[model samples]
Target: MTTTVAEELRRRELERYILEMEWEEQIRTRQAEKHFKLVEDVFRQHLGEAERMTIRQLITGAAANGRCEAMVYSFPARCCTDGGRAIEKNLPHWQKTLQGNAKELYHVFTETAKPQRYGLRAAVVDFAEGFPAEIGFFVTWEPLFFRSDESIY
Candidate 1:
């Protein structure tokens, strides 16, 4: 089989696209791992040893009866996945839920990037109806660039 010049060029372009996608995925994976560690550290400070242990169990426990909802938000970038933008748009609903649910706590998993600059922030909350009865949970990640005056970080 003979390969034409056009076909060879097309093949190279496809290969390049695939490589770029893989690289991007790797970057996201590293970011997520960093975020997880940050979350653990922040939670350790806020909760007692026993409480932290319990929370850990709940977070990692597969037996817990609940649904996990995850969201990722990115801003200051013209291009983002639909999933990322959807999470950003739903902030109001999540905020309202957080306000109403007395038992719920938004544990910030991680915040990355420069202060007053482009960055990523993430949080998770487990909603439990009663003892060990976690009904559902929500996780959110937002990547954004902030103005100097903004203080949400």
Candidate 2:
């Protein structure tokens, strides 16, 4: 078969376009991997080996125990599993109880499939020059059991 000049030029152009797209995809993948690695390193740095093991145990325990719903941890305080509604109190009262001034309060939640078909919500209360208060709540289909009575901060 005889190849026309225009047809040959079109084929080469198509090949070049495909190569360019592949190269772009590779670049994007590398960038994403690098960013994720940096994030993992930072997360590891913040939590020591023992702390990481403890956290892992909590998560795994929750997944294993059918009755276990949520785990709570108040910084500078002991960890608890009674993740019911948080008792509402005035900000000033909390500040005094925390033994430090309040800086910021945030509520963060993430859906996961590992433990169960549920979402993990955390109330992070940052204190000045002190450990933050954190309440990790498990959100499941049964609102009656795992629902938080207090509004998320």
**What TM-score would each prediction reach against the true structure?**
0.39, 0.32
Error of 1 at 48 (Å): 7.6
Which TM-score value belongs to model 1? 0.39
Badly placed stretches (over 4 Å) of model 2 are 45-153
In model 1, which residue pairs have backbone atoms overlapping below 3 Å?
none
Which ranges of candidate 1 are over 4 A from the true structure?
47-139, 144-153
Clashes of each: 0, 0
lDDT of 1 at 4: 100
**CA lDDT for candidate 2:** 0.38
